[model samples]
Target: MVEIKRPSPTDLLTIGEVVARTGVAASALHFYERKGLIHPERTAGGTRLYPRHVERRIAIIQVAKRLGIPLSEVAEQFGTLPSDRMPSLRDWNRLNERWRARLRARQLELERLQEEMTQCIGCGCVSLNACLVMNPGDQLGAEGHGARRLLPIEDEVPEGVGRDSH
Candidate 1:
């Protein structure tokens, strides 16, 4: 009869071990599983076993969360990785580059918001009828409804208005 060798416990981490090592709650790990972000192997007794490398994945997810990157975007980026193995250093670099671009865009948007926020909120009308002074006869209404000025403009801003006008 041939004898089979089982992998050492160190090769696979149980859910509790993963929570301890990653400093993530077990419920969060389960949430990640449900979101299809991480895949773990199951034991005969219905135990979950994660590869040691899952800690890296959890770290990446946490960073993305901290950056306000939506889980859907994280999942999309993770989709680019090979499912069979841990992400390589090159893979991590690629993810970093992608996230950096998103962060830059977010920073610019936040700056724009900060510059405009004072005026937007000052009137208390919040782009309603009282905003006619800034908007002027509902000219912005021609473009669209719902705080058109607040929306990001794709082309040159309309003349005779905006942050510089006031």
Candidate 2:
């Protein structure tokens, strides 16, 4: 009879095993290691061995990436934890809160940009009469480049319409 040996709970996973389990490319894992985002032990034979807890960390990283969070920001959060231990539930909660706030801020910024686009579809066109009131002779051009004053709101509006009327 052929014998099949299964990995025990304490057994470290090889890079290939982690790749199979996490669906993260081997190159990405290596890049994460190089960037100090993840720390994997090496066997005497110079093979990478990851602890089972790494799967959770990888999941967190994937979630952050999906949320449009940069790897550097994710790394900064991970760096707060002890190098020898995986993040506890409390740690994950704190990180989640921080990321949630960042995402909310980004959402607001995107909403503001969308509102500006609706206000001035052709910012470069001179035929827009409203541009004189909204942009005031391309005053945004002085604030460097690419969509300035888009975040700020003016008090004055047409008739009884408020800023959010449109």
Each model's lDDT comes to: 0.82, 0.79
Query: Which digits, one per residue and each the tens of the lDDT, describe model 1 over residues 96-121?
Result: 99999989999998887665666667
Q: Give lDDT tens digits, candidate 2, residues 1-166.
A: 9999875534588999999999999999999898788789999999999877788888988998899888998889988866566667888889889988999999998898777666676565444334544565675576665665455446445577777767
| Cα lDDT, model 1, residue 132 | 45
For each candidate, how many residue pairs have backbone atoms clashing (under 3 Å)?
Answer: 0, 0
Q: Candidate 2 — what's its lDDT? A: 0.79
Off by over 4 Å in 2: 1-11, 121-166
Model 1 spans > 4 angstroms off: 1-10, 118-166
- What TM-score quantifies how close candidate 1 is to the native fold? 0.67
- Give each model a TM-score: 0.67, 0.68
